[model samples]
Target: METWKEPQTIILWIIIVALFVIILLTSIIFLVRTIFKKIIKAKEKEAAIQLDYQKNLLETTIKTQEIERHRIAADIHDGLIGKLTALKMQQEITSKDQKTIDALHESITVARRISHDLSPPLVEFTKLPELIKELLDPWEQHLLITTIFDIRAEINDTEEFKVQITRLIQEIITNTIKHAEATQMYLHLKQTENYMALYISDNGKGYDVAKNSKGLGTKNIETRVQFLKGVYKVKSKIGKGTSNMFLFKN
Candidate 1:
């Protein structure tokens, strides 16, 4: 009864230990992969939430801007323009100097122009395409630049749509002047039965879009496009040119 040792029993015990170790490692690997997948999903959700927040912020900001512009336009009409008109009238009646009267008149006209520009002309009577044309065409007289608006389809626009579209085009032109320094710009619009396409391009000196993506103008464009539920593609590089193409499915 005291002589029960066997080599086969020792080998069997070794095999069982090896199997246990292999099983443990497999379980650990499986657990690690599961944890990694969860982490990735959590990160993706966080990113989506952040993007939503940013979009909301952008909408609020644009609305606030419109209010401020309206307020400023009222001030110009009721305050500054009023005073300037009164001064001009007094000069015309009392002053013998034609030059002084002319100067006051010019000041009044300039103030009115500024107010009109601040509040984009998205009037009830004006269509969006016409408004865009008016907005871009005037720059040719003031700047050393040429702008072309090629409209392939007539677009019926609501006031709200006109406001956002007007702002987007305004910001794009401002950016072109500030960054592109190009002398030529073109805006193309095409509307089909189901979708609409817009293209804006500049022949100016371009910047690295990757590095300049956070600019206010770019952000404004992006926010408006998102509001429109549209998709955009931008191509830009240094010393080359910049182009933005937008597509909207109705």
Candidate 2:
């Protein structure tokens, strides 16, 4: 009986030790998991804050640029263009050189064009389709541009929105002319009750979007798209062509 009791006691002690070890390991694992989760959450929070700061900085910089552009346009229209006009008038009256008058007239036209490009006047009051036509008419001399407009809903028509849209389109056109060795361009605008869409494509020598580094023009397009809370996608192939599609809330 004594031998049996000793064996039973030994078996009980073994079981107790096993239970203690299991509990200890479980507690350690739980603590480690908790620490890891806390670290992850902290990192995520920091990333979000940093992103907001960068976005705000970008917004401020863009607004400042627009303000400066407006100021410069005003100066060109009110000061330089005015002076050019007066000079042209004086030349017409005093100079017999038709060539001189023609040159002065040309200078005034160039100044006016620059001023208009810098800041379009009464943009908010203009219908978007009309404004786009006015913007693209001058470029017709450079490339074959085809446009299609389908409107079924009222647009925001705010000055800021229109200006951003205009700038975005301008940037895309400038990039195509400078880089794409293509001749024809297409623009299609569509609007519904819920959203507006813009499609622009060029029959130019397209580059691989993944391989090429984005230039300042691309960055500016991204910034303006973000400002408008719009989404855009670009597709291009080496020898095919490039196309950009943008969608915005109406």
Candidate 3:
């Protein structure tokens, strides 16, 4: 009877020790998991703050650039162009040399074009489609451009917003002309009450987006898209073509 009682006591002690070990391990695992989760959350929060800071910095820089552009445009239009116009008139009145007159006229035209490029006029009053059409006219001499506008509602946004969108389109066009080496381009603008969409494509020699996305032109497009609080996607395959789609919530 004494031997049997000793064995039962040893078995009970072993069971108690096993239970204690299991509980200790579980608590340790739970504590470790909690610590890991907290660390992850803290890292995510820091990353978010850094992202916000970068965005704000970018916004401020772009705004400064726009202001400088406006100032330069004003100076060109109000000072240089004005002086050029006066010179052209003087040349026209004082001289009959056709070549000289033609030269002055060309200079004035070039200056006016530069001024227009720097800052578009009457952006607030002009409809978006018309503004885009004007921007494409000069490029039409270089490439075949087809535009389809399905504007169901007016984009009564601010002048600054319109300017940014216009600049975004301009950057795309410039990139296509400079890099794509394509002959034809397409633009489709659609706007509704809820959103506005822009689709641009080119028949130019396409590139691997993953490789060239870091290019300055692409970066400019991305910055403008972010500034507008819009989303964009690019699809490109070498030797095929490239297309970009931009959507802005209204």
Report per-prediction Cα RMSD to one decimal.
Answer: 4.4, 2.3, 2.4
Q: Write the per-residue lDDT of candidate 1 for residues 1-250, one digit (tens) a residue.
A: 2332577776787889999999999999999999999999999999999999988987788788889998999899889999988888887788657998888888887787778667865476797667777777656663454444454566666676777777787888888877678887778877765777778888888888788889877877888888878898899877878998888886
In model 2, residue pairs whose N, Cα or C atoms come closer than 3 Å (at least 3 residues apart or on different chains), thus clashing, are none
- Candidate 3 residue-wise lDDT, 1-250, digit = tens: 6764798888997899999999999999999999999999999999999999989998998899898988999998899989988887888888867898888888878787777777989998988888889888879989999999998987687888888988998999899998999999999999999999999999989998888889898899999899889999999999888999999999
Which candidate number would show the highest TM-score if scored against the true structure?
Answer: 2
Supply candidate 1's per-residue lDDT for 197: 78
The C-alpha lDDT values of all candidates are: 0.79, 0.88, 0.90
Candidate closest to the true structure, highest lDDT:
3
Q: Candidate 3 at 30: error in angstroms?
A: 2.5
Which order, best to worst by TM-score? Answer: 2, 3, 1
lDDT digits (tens) for residues 1-250 of candidate 2: 6764797887988888899989999999999999999999999999999989988987898899899999999999999999988988888788757898899889988888788878988897888888788888888888899999999987767888888888888998899999998799999999888988999999999998877647788889988998888998999998898999999986
Task: Please identify which of the two predictions, 2 or 3, would achieve the higher lDDT against the true structure.
Answer: 3
Question: Model 1 segments beyond 4 Å from truth?
Answer: 1-52, 143-154, 237-239
Give residue 89's error in model 3 in angstroms: 1.3
Candidate 1 CA-lDDT value:
0.79
**lDDT for position 62 in model 2:** 81
